[model samples]
Structures are given as structure tokens and as C-alpha cells.
Target: MDTTPIAAGTGHAEAAAGGGVRVGALVPLSRPGWVEAGRQLLAGLELGVGDVNRGGGISGRPLELVVRDTAADPAKAAAAVEELAGTGVAAVVGEYHSVVARAAAAQADALGVPFLCSSAVLDALTDEPTEWVARIAPAQSRGWRIFADFLLGAGHRRIAVAAEPSVYWAAGARILREHLAPRGGTLVELDARALGPAALCDELVAQRATALLLLVGTPEPAVPIVTSVRHDPRLADVLIGAPAGQPEFAEWASLLGGDGAAIPFLRYLPEHLSPLGARVEAALRERLDEAASFVAFEGYDTIAVLAEALRAHHGTRTKAADFWPHVTAEGTRGTISFSRQPALTAWQWTWPPIQVADRDPANPTRFRVLHTG
Candidate 1:
């Protein structure tokens, strides 16, 4: 991670008390999956910004957005942040990957530019020496604990967890191990494999695990794992689990011929999972003619927090200090907040229960609530 400072001044005019406000997004448009995520994200932001603009445009100046594709790479992510710095964007919202967002957040903090991460899940992404990297989603560790509590409450003590080798997945695996070990339970096997077709299928069959935890965020990584597992007879009893905010599960359910076609599964939920998600769903329908995924909500919540911060700070150059307060105390995602520490608080993650007897990941056919706390 480059810790070099980025300069945010290209002499772009500051958002005046009654002047135009610009928020930029560094999204990955090349990937079909993330492109949809990004589109929903931009749509959410546009809705928020458009509402603000329509309601008299933030003290009489319209809100505007400048979007740039980061290609979802570290260097390109950094470039996107730097590019926004020169454009006088009051704040930037982007990133679905923790590692990439972590880099971009560091750049935003160095430049004193406020950044709201929409999809990054790694606790360390915002849990370090900077304040600019607040996220709308809960940390990976929090979600891990949630998943652990779910497994324990369901009387499923013997478990096997597998995730991608990415830092985010690794963090979730660690947290799950720590949380599960203390509950009179055991993680019989924990494996992190490469994200490939054969490699995933091999891991699915080779490991002596009951429940599979797919930690990779991208669908490309998750689809193969699920597809491989669906075919393997050994994994038939193993329940597939994913931390919430992954759209791949639902997409997989749909692709596998919908409900009753895939294996049973569970998902962990972040704090503040409210019915308000319907508003987001409706927005996605209008924007993309489809329902928004959990990832889409991450993006939607990100923009909500950024707009609230800008309003709270009265457009004071979009500094992190100015925005963190609003994000913590009052935000649309119901207490969206983060600190510059690597610790996971109980408020951050919760294991909500959803038992899918059918295969539809989007809307599980049959569910019995075990633990929603």
C-alpha cells in the first residue's frame, strides 16, 4: 500500500454556500457484474443528488456527479482518486473490493478528500492510521461473527469454512475461527483456494467440511465455487453460507434454474438491515429494470452517507473529520459508521438467519429464523 500523500487542489472552485456540488465515483465498468453494481450505485447517488437538486439544489446550486472507471485495480483505483482530487469533487464514493478500496481510501485521506467506501469489507481497509475511509458496510470480522452465531444457534457445531485467498476472505475466515472455537464448536477444516473452476471443485470435494463459507466478493469467484459444489456429492450435506452483500448467491440461485435447484445456505447480515431496503429495490427497478442486490445496497448506502456528510459539514471541503460525525450518528443505512482501528464491535455485525430449502438465492423458498440478533 502506497502511503504517499495526494494533493487535492487543482484550483477547482470550492462548493460554495449556494453553488454547484460535485461528487465523483470511481467504479469498474468493464466487469459485467460490478458494472451492474456500479450502475445501481450511481443510480442511488443520482437519485439522492437529484432529489437534493430538485429540492432547490443544495442552497440553490445543483448537485452533479463525475464518474470515472477504476477498472477495479489498485493502480487504477489510485488514479481514479487522484483524478477526482484535481476535479474539485466534494467527496468520492466507490470501490467494491476491500484491498482496492483500502488503497483508494489511503489516497483520499492523504489528499484530505472525504471518501465513502460502498463495498469494501476488510476491517483493515478502514481500520488503520487514517479517518477518511469510512464504509457503509460492516467489517469482514463483524460479518464473520454473525455467521458464527448463526451456525452455533442452529446446533451445527461441526463446520468447515472455505474462502478465497484475498485479504478480505482471509480476515473473515480468521474471525469465524475465533468466534466459532469458543462456542464449544470446531472448525474441522479451513481452506483458502485459488478462484478457478477446477481448483474450486477440488477444494469443495477434498475438504472434510459441512458448511462452505464463500468469502470472495465477485460473482466470477463465487459462481464457480457454487457450481462446483452443486455437482459434488460429498458436499450435498454441506450448507453453503455467504456473508451478506454478495449478489453472487442470488445470481447462482437464479442460474441453477431457480428455487430447489441449489444447495441449502445461510447469510450473515450487517447491522441496520432495515425494510428501507425496499426504497433501494425500487430505485434499482427504475434505473436498471431489475432488483438491486446486496452489493447494490452497499453502494446505495455509501452515497446516502456521503450526501449526509456533505450537508452536515456545510460543504467544508469534504474533509473526513467533517463527515465522520454524521455517518456515525445519523445516516440512512441506520447508523453507518467506522473508526480508524482494526477492532470489530458487536454493533457492526449480526448473524441474521435465512434457511433456504429451495434453490432461489434471491428469494429463498422456505426459511426458519434461528438467530436474527
Candidate 2:
């Protein structure tokens, strides 16, 4: 637990001999809406750091985390990163929303520190040239592709896409439509709303389409929409699915009862949550005491990958500029590689356990992968 700095890129033997280094964790903690998500992230990171330290710390130095709250606002997120700039953190991990991650990316780049985005879904994080920012979760673009492929294959020829105009939702819908075009399916609705649940529900119901691709972040926002979708006999045949952006589908299914059908894809159903998920399910559960929400595990895995990067180099010597190419690690989701096109790593990972659920009396609703094709 000594604060001695290990030589940058030193081996664990030497670094461990020296003790541990300090890391920074930036989460959105300033608001009630973002507090639990931030807490979940902190919980995962704590579990990860504890494991590393218990195993003799990273590069002989234990990993220390300095946490800050961004309040889920982009400007606040940037300010938080600015505060951590000169704090001498080996790396930065956090910012759950894509909006906040985008802000941290700008600051982390200027400071030349490795930034790990735990839950942000927008591909914008990896789309442009970024030296230090690497995302541990599947980009929203990939989520669109995976879900589109699953639906097209599952014989769903029609899809109704819906979301607010926010970057996260819009980006997801855009990518899904693009991926769906070649598959012989079509996005029948792209209802862009600027309102809350009830208003959004009215818009969604007006789509007049059957299969639904909900792009909202949480189930609460979609509860009214789901209620309308299931209760209205006009849309009775619709198959419901959502990206990992939202909370568990159980809320809607429980309300709709036997009216609901399976949800083929729910983004990141990490091993922690799904008994049939990624390879690291057991180990992750043992460490974090629960299966990670798609975003939480992404955050946990982000920390895990960065820890390896630090261990690989022996200590915190490599800055983001030099560390970009060296960031190669695997997690419960997939390989954490990077692509330099946007100046980020080539890592693009996904949660393959397509979470499918239904409300049949014979088969209670829950997530499971489906063969869309």
C-alpha cells in the first residue's frame, strides 16, 4: 500500500515491490437520477480495485481511486475531468452517459490520460481521433447492427424505431435503420419525441407498426409506451425489443402479463446478470456480488482492462499517447483492443447473450438470445 511510483511500464514484480498508484474515477453523482448508476459503477470499480490490491496490487503499488461526481451534465463532466487533470491519476474511468463521456473525452485528451468510458453508448466516443479514451462497452452503432441482424433473421421483416432526439437514442435508431436496409427489413417508424413517458407513448402508438425497437435509456421512460403497445389490439402482434440502454424489461412484461412476447436483444446482459452470459460471469459475480447491468459491467470491465494495461507496463509510466497501442486485454464482454482511426483502440466488443423475454403463462418473461434469421 506504499505510494512509491513504479517505473512506467515496469513488470508486476518490480511495481508490486514498490506498492500502488492512484487512479481517478469520475461518475455522475450530483443528481438523484444518476446517483444509483454512479454508485453501481463505484461498487464495480471498488470490487475490481480490491481484487487487484488483494492480489498484491498493480505493479507492486496498490490501486487507489479518487472519485468525482459530474451530475450527468456535459459541462460538469468536463469540469470534473479538468479537476482530475493534474491529480496524477494513472488513468480515468467513468461517465455513464454518452453525453458526459463526450465531455470527459475532450478533457482527457488534452491532459493525455487514458480515459475509460464505462456506459456511454454513442459511437462518437470512438468515431473521432482520440488519444486516451477507450470504451469497454459495445458502441451504440454495434448494438444497432446486432439487434437488426437478430430481428431480420428472426423473421421480423418490419421494425418500428422510436426514441427522443437525444444523441444516444437517435444514434441507435440511425445505425439500426442503416443495418436493416440490406437485410430486407425496413424501419417503419422513426418517431422523434421531445416529451415524457405519456407523450412518448402517444407518439409510439401512432406509428402503426408491429415490431418495436425502443431506443430509450430506461424502462420508466418507456412504461407508458409499453403499456400502449401491449394494450392496443392494433399492435398486438408486435415483438418488443430494446437496446441495453434501458432497465430490465420485467417491469413492462409484468404489467402486460401474457400479452408480451420475447425481447431478443437487451444489449449488455453480462455474466453477472445472466446465468447464460459471458465467460467471466462467475468470477465477476464473485467480485461484484451481482451481475452487472450492461453499463455497469462495461464500467467494471473498463477498470479491469486498464488495470492490465498498467500491469503490463509495470507501472504508470506510459501516458495515453504511448499507451494507446499497448491497450490489449480481454474481459467478460470481449477483447478490449483499440482503433487509431479515431485515435482510440481497435476494441469493439458486444454482449452476445441476446436477452429475450415473454409473458406466457407457460414461460415467464426473461432475456434469452434468439435466432432472428
Best by lDDT: 2
TM-score of each: 0.77, 0.78
* Per-residue C-alpha lDDT of model 2 across residues 232-255, encoded as one tens digit per residue: 666667777766534343444555
Q: Model 1, 312: alpha-carbon shift in Å?
A: 3.5
Best by TM-score: 2
Q: List clash counts for every candidate, in order.
A: 2, 36
Kindly provide the TM-score of model 2 when superposed on the true structure, using C-alpha atoms: 0.78
Model 1 lowest lDDT segment of ten: 3-12
